[model samples]
Target: MKQNRLIQNIILLIGCLLLNSCYQNEEYMQTVQQNHLLIDIKDSGIYSNEPISRANTVGYTTTFSEGDKIGLYAVKNGEILPDVNNVCLSYTEGKWVANSSISYSEDKVGAIYYAYYPYDQALSTFNKTSTDPFEALVSSWEIGNDLTGDIYTGKDLMTGFANAKLEGRNYTLDLTLGHRMSLAVIKLPTTTYNFTNAGMSSYNVSPQNISFTIGKDSESEAPILPYYDITSDTYRILIHPNTAYTLKGKFTNGANANKSYTINIGTDIDKAQYAQYIVDQPEIINYTLNIGDYYCADGSLVSKDGPAPSNCIGVVYQVGTTDAIKNDYPSCNHGLVYALKRVEGDPIKWSTSKPSSTNWYEKYGMLLYNATGVDIQGYEETKTWMDIETGEVEGVDINSIMKSTLNDYRQNFILPSTTTDWYLPSYKELDALNNNATILNTQFSKVNGEALWTSATKDISYWSTTIRRQDAVVQYHPDNKTKAGYIRDSSGYYRYSFGF
Candidate 1:
């Protein structure tokens, strides 16, 4: 029995060896398929059919690398396989391709591969109708919208798509990438100034340090952008493709480093369509901001012609008045009186309208120096004396005080008589001026040939006759609602005043 068992074991061992040999031979006979994927990138501006290289990467310095996310899908046996979504493409030497799990298979000669760069969604599982196959997952920082926030910077949304069927073990796919953002390569004109001029000169501008911003009007927040200064007069900035943007450009001048050189670049550009627009009419979008476009605060320009600079206070509103100036205005039929242009600087700190600081006394008529010690910190209801008809302090004749101060200031300046009686507008009145700023600016532009307000000229201290205590009312332009406008100390000489 032992001999018979040994014989059977030897036969079993031989049979196992033969079967393993046959299996090995079968595997060796099967062919290994090798395939390749090719890529091409194109710009919307230059749609040259060229493959993207390191030199042509629009917003980035380097191309896809190891662990770079990409979307891929395969079709085998005429049926789409499981999508290899967001798989990192491996970088070998210079080329990038998906790993074996996504592209390699012995019988995958007929397979088709689809790939996209900067992958965010699973291209393989993309819904044909509802999903956008070419969209990238861009962040806000990447968009880098111009100051107005409506225009997108073109540098961030780089998208590409490629598809090719594998054949004969190896195949090359040709993909193309195109820009979705509009292109604005502006060439700023050389600013030539009359040397005889005494104001700002374009020669002082630092070309490389210039800033360009674009967006909608409501987008006041400016985004920092990388700009290329191709030449002293040329600049390039990337912007979003499909939206309109309001543009603002600024640079520092060596002559007036304390001041900013500013220009409004107009707001009709639709960045998405910029490329085509340029293609159609190259001169249409190729703008050149002239040196003369810069805003100046010179008072002489006030009566010249054009819109007022934002720094200047515009009209408050139109009110019926018999002031002689209204008779010459375009709206003479309405007896309209324009508010005084807002000025900068601190004016008089002392006012006769205020009561004496040391006495803290309430009087019907008392002259006082720039008084202090009025505390209205928590007095919400006592904000204005408009409603108080009884108190001598709150109900003091505001018109009389206005008439005297306006005449005094005019005489001091030795200027011509103003159109209307000038007086410190009440708090509510000033607030109204701020709220109706748009209308005020428009009407002033129409009536006055040139209107510009001097901003923060001398930190002018203005006196408000409306007093709460020993403290007379005072206002500083660009001052906020809660503080900075109220004056308590009045020991110094008055330097500035306000009127409406």
Candidate 2:
């Protein structure tokens, strides 16, 4: 009986060895050398293969820190493996480690792989957007405010997957996560001086589609407000691919309070993967201002050739008011008003004059003063300099001249002014004047006013009301992208402007 038992044991051992040999002949069979999976995380925005620091990644994706989670799915033979479904991994130090690593078992080998960031335990399965292009539905992910929340992760959605053939013992995947969303960086105009604070008046969004243009499904839209970044003074929205949106802007201060702008972001919006909407002045106000209107000192505009209002100081030679400025001074007809003449007559030698030599020009070596915090748009800046602390500032002098010396403007400047006060124009104001010099000059001649641009301000730059830290930014006539505007000038003409 003992001999018979020994013979059966030998037969069983031989059968087990022969079974292992048969398994080796299969494609998924592996040599004993390799067993673990090797995965690498990458940002497809920067699009790199060789390992690089996270800083090199682009757009909202920062360097990965410890504890960041990743979920993976390994599918084989048209179905996901039971054990490897939604496997969670964590980033530690500089490597991604798994809770229980997927082994190079025959079942796990020769399989397709899919990976997603911010692993959620509840997400058992996710739908694919398309099969041919291998797109995964990122719609399930909700976009949070990047400014208020974790700026790097929640706002952006990323995915990594592989659908190609796999036949190796050890599974290796370069899981480069690609962005499936778009960015809309909406910037308010700098001249939106009236915007003490910002708010969204209207926001609407439609479901994302594979095509660039979304269907007319207004009833199925969602309300999504773009994240407003106070630091940059801009609005940012993280949008799913080909998602249509509509944004209307309103500001806190009076002008923007009364007025609002609606922008329909539809087919015109660039909807490519990882694409960005343009940063531009989408649309200005819906009003127009004719050049050569009589400008009252109180910041009001009278029709061309009409009787000047009480305290009329000049005529409207330029209509370059920004949307924000238009919001502030509607009485000015959303245009710029230049005085009939410059201050202290001809351009002085800057400092030798009483205004220049005063503490205003106390900054050494430089011609302009170091007057700080003078960026107010309308009456505020003039009030600070003229302090109309008077004798020292031109605002007082200009007011006196308009009321007394300039006979025609004296009553016009005094007519219960809508703008209420006048001051030297800011840098932006001056540029607005210079930009339309041609149209302004023609109107000025017809209205019998000083030539908007004379030989005095042509070759050299004029002193702009905008002065900062010994530097004066003037309107240079280079007219090219390199030198369109924003140049400093030592020579200047102190000219007063109506309203702002």
Candidate 3:
């Protein structure tokens, strides 16, 4: 029984040794899988062979050798394999690196974990028992050009490449160089002065002193430079950054008078400012008068000869035997002092009588008259008269007879005055007079049906001294006479005289 126990102990000793060897191998594989140099290909099925396993070693890893065609398989779940159907291969540092052609499948855990590393053709395959083929390949390969420039570098098989510089580094790039600038210039309308009638065709005006301020808005805090030119009495300004500017000009005239004008130099100038520059000039003020006509409120017209001291054109009238310059008269008599007619319309009657006063006749005391007939009650009174036997007298104070006869004449004609200034009207004055023939015939009476003579005459004949058509020849009379017209029968026959 002791001999049987010794044999059993030897068998136990062999089993313990084999168990220790397996445990050591497993631990070494796990350590290789966790190496930093290995690109994690566990989730990348980039080859059509088995994953990195103890069973397949040649397809999972490769080493670079001249003219070698090694197929690289991606790792998936800590195993290198050639089972990746959708896989692609690329060269890095003269070695074939592998990656999955398709994006990581969302259903797989850690599907983004894929990797490859520099490899060589000589070491054509990984050991069958090795767990990390990517780490092993990296350790055996030499680095080459990473393809990305100085800004980036390759870090690991799975971590691919990264920007090698620090964050927030500053850089500048010129998009375009040696470019030409384009500009637009808008000219404002100009003002001109002209004097056509005054014999001035053109006049010279001086250029105005002006200034401009540029800004973004009317108010902005940017430093801007301005450039300008003045040519042909116009101002041209250019401001940097193509912004808005305010412009002002000061102008002075020959008379030393000064004025200021403001404008805007921008895309949109104020409309009112532009309009003010286009204003219209004012008109001149001067004129003349015509001759031979009197300037009146209504207009000009032909004038007439009038009186002196107050040289105004007085109205004209005719004189009759019965007309008088005094206001008092016979109770039944309504005589005229002078007969007048208006140049406009029908004749208007006027008198110098004082209302409600008996001293009216005394106011016209300078008036005188004569008569050669019978004695009348007011005879010596020199203001009344009576018919007496006729006698030829050169001059007589037959004032009473004349006054009474004059009173009768005044009452029947159009008269303007009763003062002694009343005289027989002139020819031109009478001709211009306005008269109504219908009224005149009805107002006057003729004794013995005889027309009496007036103070107005032509040559030896007693002719009416009224003007006609601005001429002196035409006269009115009852008897058509060559040189003498019958006034009354000399005591029995008709007689004529040159005096009224």
Candidate 4:
């Protein structure tokens, strides 16, 4: 009886062992079926400029049944290998569309899952295990609020979607998913201001425009707005939230006069007050004058005490009279005369001895008398004493000689004849010569008894070169004509040519 009992006990033990093996196998199969393999799908947009990584999760789920495990494994195409002892099932809402070129298949489940996947739980896991804090941030997401209908078991979500789910939890992804992102572009208010220096004006501003990014994420950084610098004379305004910004003011003064301007930003600026302020800080105006040292009308160098011509030296020649003795004193009887005269010294000198009665004037006494004689007839009688003696007797035309001598001096000595070979005096030159003669006569007693002719010829109305329109004393002068002055005469002179 004892032997039989031992044998039965051994057989029972063997049967128990086999039954336990069978149950364990069935339980393993059931576990595999219930728990689906959790894979985090990271949607990186269909058309992306940057590369995206696959989604990864940490801390596997412990509440999975044996059959659940089978379900998880069945979804995987290749052999389902769980890294952690505790398996979990999580979904991801990938950025994939219906017409996406992604190739995907499932080995176990028949349920057609759209591009949607659980992203919240996956993000949580990713955050827990990721070395970078920003790794869990969904770089690509869905657009609509409802992601369930668009998600698939093996596909990703559509591109440009802003919302998604992770591990069965809804999460709003703050990711730069699209190829292009739109920012709320706000134009900042511009303030204009003006500045002037040396009769020049310019306008400028401080800031140009303001720009910011608008979205549903807290991690998003504001866009970089342009800035203005006073030193660089460039301005940029970036309109932002919750901040009072000022635009640098600028202005342009057309006349280039020194003036101050205020820059007002909003509609609340006080124009009167600003104007007062500008007035108080008035800019100093600077003017330039074209003037030189004062001198006598005789062209002699002088100091401040020296008399200044009523008009500019340039215009004085236009209305002045000719003086006969201007070139050679005590001898020649031809020169420019001035209406306004100035003596060299304080005391005026007069002589009791007559010019011809003086002993020093004996040799030229007869010549002078003959030249001044009024009974001379024709050109022969007008000849000078020197000309008659030398057998080169020519008509001593005083007016002709004056014009020729003036032209010769101007063309040779007064001007740079080498560079400018043909800068002859114009008709205006004659007018200037006549005016110069008048000034000489009035200023000096040496310019007596001379006849100076002007280049102006008489037309049907009046002098050809006379100014007609303007009547002011400043305007009547011929020297003011915007051209070169010239002289003319009916007599011929010895002309010399320089060898080139």
RMSD values for the candidates in order, in angstroms, are: 19.9, 19.6, 49.5, 35.1
**True-structure Cα RMSD, model 1:** 19.9
The sequence of per-residue lDDT tens digits that candidate 3 reaches over residues 115-164 is 23322334444432445443454443322212122211121122121111
Error of 3 at 132 (Å): 53
Candidates sorted on lDDT, descending: 2, 1, 3, 4
TM-score per candidate, chains pooled: 0.34, 0.38, 0.15, 0.17
List ranges where model 2 is wrong by over 4 Å.
1-33, 46-62, 127-136, 139-141, 144-147, 163-171, 191-234, 252-259, 267-500
Better of 2 and 4 by lDDT: 2
What TM-score, to 2 decimals, does candidate 2 have? 0.38
Question: Which candidate achieves the best lDDT against the true structure?
Answer: 2
Candidate 3: where is the Cα deviation over 4 Å? Answer: 1-200, 218-232, 253-257, 264-500
- Candidate 1: tens digits of C-alpha lDDT, residues 1-500: 89999999999999999999999876654333343344333333322112333233223222444455445555555454654435445555656565644444455455555444455543343432323444433223255544222222224344444455455544555554445444454443222222232322222122224565565446774745535433333344555544445555655332222222233333333423322111111111121222112122211112113444442322323233222223333222111123334322334333234333443334333222233532211111122232323334454333233344445754554311222223344334334444555555454566442232235233333333334334544442335332233342442122222211
Lowest summed lDDT over 10 consecutive residues: which window, candidate 2?
202-211
For candidate 3, the lDDT comes to 0.27
Taking the tens digit of each residue's C-alpha lDDT, what string does model 4 give over 25-125? 88886555444323332324222111231132111111212222111111122222233211233321432122112222233333222122332323332
**Relative to the unseen true structure, what is the C-alpha lDDT of residue 477 in candidate 1, on a scale of 0 to 100?**
36
What is the lDDT for 420 in model 3? 30
Best by TM-score: 2
lDDT of 1 at 254: 22
